[model samples]
Target: MIPLGGAAGRVAGLVLAAGAGRRYGGPKAPVFLGPALRVLRDGGCDPIIAVLGAGARRTRAVVDLAGVQVVDNPGWAEGMASSLRLGLSTAARLPEVSAVCVHLVDMPGVSALAVARLLAQAHASCLTRACYDGEPGHPVVLGRDHWAEIIETTRGDQGARAYLRRHAGHVTAVECGDVAGGYDIDER
Candidate 1:
């Protein structure tokens, strides 16, 4: 199903949808990039958890399509770091989730296949990041080992970028040959 090696192990799809979207003045996750797409609709990357804040209700409603799990971030307004912490904390508890692909909901072009590939690559290589477009993007395939560190840094604006930089040695870049892989549309 997930394309990972050997046993299924545990892997998670962690969607970050908690931003305030100050510029767009609304929730970005709900933007209908393409609800009809087959890859996102049928890929079956489940336990699809979405971290929601700011416009939590709206985001929940939009991404909740077909029953996706939504986790509330109490300190989400603090920044992406808090949201990341909330997500990783929840992901750490899933028994089948040995790895996590941190996703940005508004990265509309990201497909479930890319996510599966990253998840598989993480297990095969035992690494912590799945880069795209020559740069690190969403769906960062974090191995089971990095859960502790990700959960601990839950304050201010501290984010995964710093850690990604520190652990650059274990990163793997999977180019989808698409700019959408590197694009970040934050209500703009």
Candidate 2:
């Protein structure tokens, strides 16, 4: 079991909110950003980063983004990988950040409890992902050691799927279905 408190290391929260939401008809940021940030904050993550694109202006206008470190991703249309890279890059610059817990704005069902579980299990050398009913899902915790490889292999909308699959053996899947729903709000 991972040790508690100070020895656990620092984990930054990265919310990928830059999606175009083509199918959902508008920006998801207005609907999901607040709760996502709250979950990360309440779950023990510091310096949360929210990547904005597509409807950034409107998102900023509608959402009450108080404590988050907002970063605009001009290449967001390229897809999730771009936002992921942006968030990771921003987090990596902070010397205190040892890992990042990635969350998607569209997934409002991912609770603070699930995020806490993921953060609680985090390790500087391990890639921990939240799973729903044994199926791997989001709020993925990626150690600093894996960021470079993930940033290199990720493309299009796949995010870190390719890199995770390539190093599946190193991942520790934690069951979070009981605490959170791993569903994406992709459609209206």
lDDT digits (tens) for residues 57-114 of candidate 2: 9889988888889999999989999999988889889888888999999998898888
Q: Per-residue CA lDDT of candidate 1, range 5-43, in tens?
A: 431565666777777777777767666323312233343
TM-score, every prediction: 0.82, 0.94
Candidate 2 Cα misplacement greater than 4 A, ranges:
1-7
Q: What is the lDDT of candidate 2?
A: 0.87
Best by lDDT: 2
Candidate 1: pairs in clash = 10-96, 10-97, 10-98, 11-97
Q: Give, for candidate 2, the lowest lDDT window spanning 10 residues.
A: 1-10
Roughly what TM-score does model 1 have, to 2 decimal places? 0.82
